[model samples]
Target chain A: MRTLLTGNYAVAEAVKLSRAKVIAAYPITPQTTIVEKLAEMVEKGELDAEFIRVESEHSALAAVYGAAIAGRRAFTATSSHGLLYMYEMVWWVANARVPLVMAMVTRTIGPPWNIHTDHTDLLTMRDSGWIISMAENVQEAFDLTIQGFRISEEVDLPFTVGLDAFQLSHTAEVVEVPDQQEVDEWLPERRQSYKVLPGNAVTIGNIGPNEYTAKLRYAMAKAIEDSRKVIEKADNSFGEKFGRKYGGLVEEYRLEGAEYVVVMAGAWCGDAKDAIDRLRDEGLPIGMMKIRYFRPFPKEEIKRLEGKEVLVVDRAFSMGYMGIFGMEVSSVIGDVTNVIAGIGGVDVGVEDFEAMFRKFASRKLQRLEWWPREVFS
Target chain B: MLTEVMILSFGGQGGVTAARILALAAVNEGMFAQAIPQFGAERRGSLVRSYLRLSDQPIRRHSSIKKADVLAIFAEKILKIVEVREFLRDGGITVLNAKHGIAEKSYCVDAAGIALSLNLVAAGWPIVNTAMAGAMAKPLEISIESVINAINSTFSGELARINARAAEIAYREVKKCQAGSST
Candidate 1:
């Protein structure tokens, strides 16, 4: 059904369609609505699921982790401080190889205290062995979430779908929600290699020797690397079934003969695309490479823009170094302009992107520039 | 064509809900729309603003509307607090919940009166959002029927009936006037 929904509600709809057996989460700004909707569905008997009201985000993920290990499809969602609060359990769940889906409505981590969009919170899990994907809009938030379960279950990995706080979470837009029968036909039952059954006495994540720990880490690394294909395949299958396919790991927009490419992720990519379109209409050779999947970083796709003038716009930065995403893209493309913009939800509109593209095309922008310069000045 | 609307209202006045209803109405009319409520640490009676974008094509830009093609003020008192002229584009339409029109392309409607007449009072405040939404339909280029359907689908029972009636009354009574004109 085509209906208007916020990204949070769309995610809840996806979870309902995915038939998540367990829903556990702690309330946090932006992310609260996703789980709230789920709880409402559960209460109204519209969805058959156990809605666990955990006191903290830590217990939220832990509850879902326990449920997933018991071979039940489970889900949880958090943002900003809530995600940080669940940091330890995040690693535990990922290393345990329990298939679960998490909706991360990304918010800025703060000392002054902010509840707005940024990638810093989600990017903190870069090496946690979880599959991370970002959605650019409400429809993709629904699509990526449904696909997250399919990919996670296939690879026995935890998946986190990130959408910008407020921009996607609070903004209501049209989303094509697939029928439960259609989703069920596309998503199979949760496949766990080994379930922690009631009769089975199994001690998972026991104390391991140095080599054993290294070996487990190696396996996780290999599984995630292999899961890239699974991600692509799931996306292709979803596209075929739902008639909507965002490019597997990275979606490209008019990058064919472009001399300059802007790479970004999250909801702002929509604005960036609009900027690129306007710039292209003005005869400027600029395109955008939106990173749909952040973890298992799209190195292959970044390599395609090797010779082009690549500009990476990161909403989150790795203090004392540079933008996290820019660092990764630069590592692959050798040299690229890195601009740290939109931090703490400082609005970066189409005009801002158009100006950035124009500056990059004219070789006027510095290699690393803080946007809305006055903030840094 | 893209029409951006900025709705200014006090918190708890359903300014955000008004934007949502209008967006839904636009969608029901086979157009793409986005309703973005400015999320903030706000309380009841605080100044709040929400945005709506209606377009024939998909809306890719998610930023806050800097210059709005239409400014819908839910409370006439909000005019004293917020400079509506600053947010509106050149020759933009103004839909004010007031007895008199305030701008060159202003549309005036007694949304509060309609809401009160319909007994649509919540927390001692007249619920003028639906009436204001109906007052906005003509200027937004969306059919009044679509707005009515959206209201019906959004609310339920007798509340939906009264709210839809308020919208209908406001739609019929909304008057367009020149700058500073009472009629």
Candidate 2:
């Protein structure tokens, strides 16, 4: 059925549909409403589940990890400072190989107390060994979340679905919500391989020898690396069931025969796509590639940019390194233009992108430029 | 084409609710709509804005409105903020909850006055979001039935009737203004 849902509520609805048995979370800005809605659903008997109220973000993730260990499909959510607070548990959940799912509302970290969109919060967890994916809109928030569960359980790795702070979190859009029965058929009950059953006790997360620790780390890495195919399988099945298909790892828009491609992720892709279309209309060869999954980086799809000049537009700058996204792309595709724009929720409209395209197409822009640089600022 | 509407008013006046109701109305009509609130350290009397976008297709850009096709102002005081007037796209329509006229393609209605008469108050101030939304719907070509239905769906019983009454008055008043206008 079609309904008007905020991105937060859409995630809550997805969790309900996914039949997550355990939801543990602490409330925080933007991300607060998602768990709040889930709590309300649990209270109202709409969704049968245990909603644990944790005192802090660290405990929130710990509670979900505990639930996962007990053989339950678990979930939690956090943003910005909350995520930073849960940093220890993030690595704990990944290292322990718990198949939990979390919705991360991306926000700028603050010394100035900003509550705006940025990728820094989620990007900081790049090496935590969790499957990370970002949604471009509210519908994708629902879709990716539903698929997140199967992907996470398949690999026994926790999954984090990232959405822009208020851009997607607070925004309400028309979403085609699928029926519960259909979703149930699409995603069967959680059959965890490892369980903390009372009679069958086994040592977990205990100190091990150097060789054992190394193998465990390698196993975690291999699971994430092998997850590329599992992610695709989940997306394909979801598409067949719900009639919506987001190209598994990356979605390419208007890239055919294009000379230049702008790389980005999350909700900003909408404006970037609009800018690309406008540039295309003006007879410029510009395209867009939106990265969905960041963990098992879609190196194959990105490597396809062999002859094309790629422009990486990042919303978060890694201080001395400039944009983290640009740095990562550079590691793969040798030379690329790094444009740091839209940090702290600065509006980068189609007009700004159009101007950038004009400059890139005309060879006026020579090197990496931070938008709203000292001059524009 | 996407129809972007930005609602400007003081906090506690239902600017965010107005955005939600507008999006709901659009969705009820089988169109795609997105509504977002401009979050900040806003107090009761502080200025606030909410954004809504409606389209036959999904809305892509989630940023705050830079150029809005329709600008609905719930407070006359906010008109002093230059950015409020600057956000309107060229040849765009403006819906104001004020007593006086403006020099553009605009419509005026005493939305707060109507809310006050209806005794709809939140935080001791007359709530004008639904009224402003009603006035906005008319100028933006949204259906009165959808606005009223949205109000009914968002609220219930006496409170719903009070807001619905305020919205109905503004909707009829704005229609009368449209009927009387030459431009």
DockQ of each: 0.83, 0.75
Misplaced by over 4 Å in model 1 are: B181-183
Give lDDT: candidate 1, residue A227: 93
Per-residue lDDT for A259-358 in model 2, tens only? 9988889898987788888888888888988899998899998999878988888887888776888888888989888888888877777778888877
**Using alpha carbons, what is the TM-score of model 1?**
0.98
Candidate with top DockQ is 1
Candidate 1: tens digits of C-alpha lDDT, residues A1-377: 88999999999999999999999999999899999999999999999999999899999999999899999999999999999999999999999888899999999998779998989999999999999999999999999888999899988899999999999999999989889899999998887777887889999899979999999888999999999999999989888999998889999999878999999999999989988999889988888899999988999999999889999999999999999999999889787899999999899998898888788899988889999666798
Off by over 4 Å in 2: A198-200, A374-377, B81-83, B175-183
RMSD of every prediction: 1.3, 2.4
For model 2, report DockQ.
0.75
| Full-model lDDT for every candidate | 0.92, 0.87
Q: What is the lDDT of candidate 1?
A: 0.92
